[model samples]
Target chain A: MKRTASPSFAIYTPDSSLRQPLRLVGAMFRDLSSGRELAWRLAVRDISAQYRQAALGLLWAFALPVANALIWLFANASGVVLIRDTEMPYPNYVFTGTMLWAIFLEAANAPLQLTTAAKPMLAKINFPREAIIVSGIYQTLFNAAIKVVVLLPALLFLGVQPSGYLFLLPVAVMTLVFAGTAVGLFLTPVGLLYTDIGKTFPLAMQFMMYLTPVVFPIPAQGIAATIFRINPVTPLIQTARAWLTGSLGTDLVAFGLVNLGTVLVLFLMWVIYRAAMPILIEKMSAS
Target chain B: MSDPLIKVENVSKKFCRSLKRSLWYGMQDLGSELLGRRHGDNSQLRTDEFWAVRDVNFELGRGECLGLIGRNGAGKTTLLRMLNGLIKPDTGRIEMRGRVGALIALGAGFNPVLTGRENVYINAAVLGLTKAETGRHFDEIVAFAELEAAIDSPVQTYSSGMTVRLGFAIATTLQPEILILDEVLAVGDANFRHKCYHRINKLMTDAAVILVSHNMDAIAQTASSLALMDGGAMTVFHEPVEGIAAYHDANAQRQATTSDGGTTHQCYAPVVAAEVRILPAEVGYQGQLTVEAEITCDADLPEILISFTATNAYEQAVMCWHSSRHPSPLGLCKGRQLLRFSVAPLLLDNGSYHWNFKITRRGSLEHVVWLTRHGPLVVKSRHRTLGNIPYLPDASQCEHRMLTSP
Candidate 1:
């Protein structure tokens, strides 16, 4: 067959046909987003996979929040600690923050976690990248959900009294859940902009773990505390603790509102990520 | 600047890579030093220096198979990466008008944890095969790769050869408008490589193929025209045959130019090692070449037996000749040694062939002091074209074998 090059020239014009490609891209994402059910299943699979390969198994999961709480208990038992002497035992205070923000961020980080680790999978395989992220996040959520449900009775036995504010804790937790998820959503797409974001994530988490009240309380309105609250997660952490220990009072509403505001920020990022995903992956795939 | 399906105008790329830490604690020491800001430590962006592919330009028309030829570190891969848009050029622009599919590095996109099937789907999609298109061609791909049994298994379990084979299968199945194959065919056995190149050649219905490979014969056979790339520049652009010749010449000259040119003709040794040709016997025309060698040296020279061997384009030997000890009285010193054997040049049908020579000490052919491959001896045939003869049975076998006596 005689194959010849199409030789021609013309002025550039707006290509409506280009829009057809966007439609295709949209269809692809729809196909991707359509896998919500699959996403959940993959998350469960990931959770099982992590815990399955360990001799300690799921004990480690329980151990993480509980042991973390016991350390606070021991530290407070020394009475050198500040917030516990004010009233609440240190474990309950720490557990409240850990339950609300720590668990959620930890779960959210899952989706973005091996984002670098699963990089080989992303580069080499055909699975949905977002699905992998969502799966990991979901697995984290499952872990968090189990930890909290199991901790509720112990929480009361530990001399932590429950008031109506404890009911508001779920709302506080959901807000943080979506807020942390939005961070994950933002991280994956922006990560395409820089090569080292994945490497620095755990470090960023270390800073956040300290900045938020997972271990100690930072009273509201101090200058240093405000800097720590710079992460929208701080308020959510404080809110979760307050609700569980009946200390939320009026700030719980404000914390939920801030989380909702962060969601809008995520919405904007979601748009940018959607725009950049194909182009980024395309650049990565070239020989 | 003119309208080409792919316009590569002064396009070049350089990557900034931190040298891999050769020792443990290398990064830790560096980090601590940097954080401490030790006195007189001139850490002046040593990590950020540039390794560049300079300005290179080439354009591809539709249905064009442009060969890219170069020595190692000659910027051919850098140029290919630019065209494929894998990495952006450090300077200049590469403008293309259609979907570009690059099988740049084989299995560069395959995920080992995923099943072969899942990889096929996503890999195809990334390679510009849409979801539906990937689904449609999936079976043909599996069949071609001959991996039906293991399609559902994770690719990590596969051998490197199998991974490459499956990759080539998937990439070629696209039959893309523009197919960028970068040394991908180097994988697999010779028989399979032939099948792959043949399949790829047949797929030139309307596809523009840009092939980068180390095999000149392959480039000559598969590509329409060749583009020779050197240190960040286009050296020669021509038809495949001529390109192959120029490449050989350039490489020979490169070795010659870079070396201490003491033996003015030491550079010419490989080219002029032997006078060889193949021509037809009819009408005073020698069409096929039969190479016979003669070894003449001083009697004082170590007693040696000279053997001659012939290899076809595939590097397979078709014929060989060995010369026994020369009569000691012939005065081996300062005399022309002629080891002459002739073929009617009938068996070597077509394509390039290399003549290999071996010189060994007396009584031991294994003591090879000299070995060389005479590259690119083309056998021009007129009357017949025999494609890859496997066995040469005796001609008498076909004539009434039933009455044969032991």
Candidate 2:
């Protein structure tokens, strides 16, 4: 339904209404549709700036994760960390899993990185601030596309044929992004105030990867398996892998609940972000 | 008319000096917003916090300009930010009818690593332009900045003037209905600054402009109304001249109270009656400016310097005269002293001006009495001047000047 603002002009204050969640959702939809060109421009700026004067440029995007997956593969093969057998080749399995994890990581980092980078602009210009987030997501997706270029070729070389459930890959990726960004949006305000979160996020994410079954199969009965079950990202990563291979996961209920929880939590995060952004911006600029 | 295009009502903003307390307060504010609680009174400031802008009320109609002038941290920039929607006020509201274009800082959104051409696109987008819109005006923007040769070069390589030119060009392209300009003339060369003033004058016919500048001349030339801000409070003057006078008075008072010599030393102000008169009615005919003052001092004083500064209507210095420049030392004594001064063959064109008078210690910078905008002097013009500027030089001097004399 098309919604019209009762008052065309807006009055803003530090203590203004958060607006109804429904109204915020409506505004987000409006900005996404109308401000698409601006978002595209901002994304293009980031991509061009990121690649300019660089020797390797965009290749570094895929190269980093490829190196990461290779380390785990070598560890398992050397019997340093024994891995459970999988239906697909271990290299292809690890590659896709690590590549998907990278996407989540980028999505999780987008809010803080984009907001920090745009601080000066935000303090002076008054455009739709949400364009920053939209542009950030677009940049993250572009980076993921670079990773897919290598991931696709690796899958083909490993002779892993595409499965019917491969069509669900986009949905699975969406769930991962939504879940990751939900936590990111919730923490963005805190990160804006304290630099510690931004400084330690990469290290924290590295440790978090071990708790999820990214390279190895989930053990049936062990402390590792219990951690995997409890971890919020487990269902997302497992389901994405199941879709990539022909084998579907055993627990459909867990997948549904995780997806549902992700959507709810993401909506809540959007509410918090909308309410806190102005206050955060005012404080950040003053300091 | 038709309700003002911009209305700022009792707007206030508070700022905290401590980062930790600011963050905590922000979180608490956010929680209150989520819970739909009423905002507490913002006029009362807590420790480590102060109101950046308080109870600022004003309105602007279409085609009107409001000039904001204040010392640093008086909340002029903060008020502009609120009007531009970059920051929300802590109390009251700012309502406006159309798009707001702000050039609050030069090169504010430009990426240093990006070429000027690329930065133009991003900055236009940041100012609310679509990709196609920016593309359509791309050539014009570059032309306006006069940076066609350097368009492909990285912005970091550009000089500060070049950066400001490009930023101004991009920001003004939208011709927004409500434009907020903050200290844009603080950079750029004289020629470009004049061009900017001309361009802004063109935009003034249809837009409501909120201008914050330290250049008194810029304010007086462009603004129909003026606001004087101090300590987070604002007083608006509908008449441009009155506003300028109030600004000068406040500024003089502030200087008197804060200057080390003025505040620390014991001194007395000699009462004086001052008046300024222009001779021959019109300029360009060897007109003269005369100033007369009757000074009465309680006790005899030696070695006092009496100085006069002539400022144009915009409060820019046109000329200065000092008794100390003479071979004989000017002195003050008990009872009354009558002083008369005249500058014959005044070079000023037809204009209204304010005369600033100062009495200081002969050898030191210490001001005994500083009277700002003491009186008005009016000079009429019978014939047009040689050039656009008010200063007029002798015809023989202008005519005899050789093209390659150097």
Candidate 3:
């Protein structure tokens, strides 16, 4: 009786959907809500399938950040390059930085990764497109959780004291995730269309890491310091590391402003993604 | 009549021939959408662009199955995609009232490393079913797929047919009010196919269905009305018989132009020239028919086998005659050879037909020299028959007897 009384109805037209802003936003929210269960199922499926065959399993998630930390420690110890004195031990500082950066990188890459993996289904099934985005977030959060589990113990073992500020670590880590996801979501439409984006994304992220105080402390006064201060990633990562190490020099104001900006930009990118999906799917299916 | 559940109005979508151009155009279109600008006159095509589905219109009420019959690349899938809301049409509007379920790509998102049990839940979720709903249908889905024993095994271990069966089962379990199917019936074994059709028939009682399939029998059995698509355009036929006829005529015409005179195999003994002639160019039902073929050979051959297949107007092979099965064997020398084949009392119903001839070496099934799609062999009959081959016995062979009532 309910099904007959209120059968779902949908209309698709060539007219610009942006012309109907209210409807567009309404549909977006509706799909996002309806897509949650599907997104969770997909995330579970992907996470299980990903590590099932890999002998390394969850170690693969830890592999990247740990290896990066090891590489930087080796470089710092061998005096291969001059480094600024960190407020915390170099090992602890770089370890926390790389761990946080890995979370950011995973968040940044999740949108495109999940989307590309689901391209076949995207072209064929008429499911809520937002499910892919939500699935990406689920996976990102899952991976971030794993990295945090590894980080907390490793940080304490490395002589860093957990402080009262530790309660804010999740907020800081989420802000970084939000910022990274915003950038990734913004690029998803074009990235889906072109191979060049996927190919060059890693190199671009690596270059950005050097500017974000991931491998080295921010230069006291120089062109590098100017760049680091100007980089939006700086405050987010620095605050997350400070929260973990109980440091007093956290830029809370800049971090909050960056978080606010990330929210606005993420929403804007989501709208763009929603609008561009049909065209992208058509192009993808056609080719 | 019930209110129409699906209505499509003058929908058209353009695609670029070159991938580069298509991506570039996609970027431009995305920019316009982002800027809130109207998609600049969709009627006009840019360079390297052409309309994939042009000006298609249709409406389907509940309980109606609209069969889409067309050659490959005839925009049937494109139109279906638009109706499924997977992609937007560049030019018109599509209104779908009620939940839309698509079997366009069964098992589309199946992860091979996951077990069939897991994949079913994922697939059902993708079709818009909740986890609890999938759980409720889990046993039925597995039973329908006949994979109860292997359902726990990883999908990678299952055969392709098993996977398809699982996909079909999960997709159909949703029972949405609008179903979009694209060539899904072409898979699975005959028994499973029968089950799929039976399920679809049940689903059709309360749903609007759009089925795109090349299988004519399936179309005729399922569709209430048929839409024949050609060159991105459509002609609707309320009568399935007329639509199938038009489809066959179109097929015959296209085959005539593009036969390529059969693909000539460059074997050691190649057929240089070949000609086939019927004893009587015009054949009548239940008449003795004789066929003669002259094949010129380039080299001497020890033993050759010739086979003849006669296909009716619907492209269904009605009769087959092979030479190797006969008592005598024929050989070819380094010259033109005349091969004669005769059939007595042809039982084919009145219709136009084509003959396909194949010449192969003895002991080998591969065609050494093949001449295909040779004729419009017209057969006429005094009394009309119902099916392809009429059961007409010769008068001398027929006997009538009167029995006492018991």
RMSD of each candidate relative to the true structure? 10.7, 9.1, 3.5
lDDT of 2 at A164: 80
Q: Judged by TM-score, which candidate is best?
A: 3
- Model 2 TM-score is 0.79
Q: For candidate 3, give the lDDT of residue B23.
A: 87
TM-score of each: 0.62, 0.79, 0.94
Pairs of colliding residues, candidate 2:
none
Native-referenced TM-scores of chain A, all candidate models? 0.76, 0.89, 0.95
Candidate 1 vs candidate 2, lDDT winner: 2
**lDDT of candidate 1 over A1-287, digit per residue (tens):** 11111112211111111234556356446635644444554554455446645778777666766776667777777776645432366667776655565576665575456455545434433334455555665666676677677677878887877788777766766677677777776776545445576678768876778777677666566776786756667677776777777666545556867876976876554554443343344334322
Model 3, A139-169: lDDT tens per residue? Answer: 8888888998999999999888888988878
Instruction: Give per-residue CA lDDT, model 2, range B5-70, as digits (tens).
Output: 898888888888897888887777777777765443435776789888889899998889999998
Residue B204, candidate 1: C-alpha displacement in angstroms:
4.0
Model 1 chain A scores worst on lDDT over the 10 consecutive residues at A5-14
CAPRI-style docking class of model 3 based on DockQ: medium
Candidate 2 Cα misplacement greater than 4 A, ranges: A1-8, A13-15, A19-22, A85-88, B39-43, B106-108, B259-406
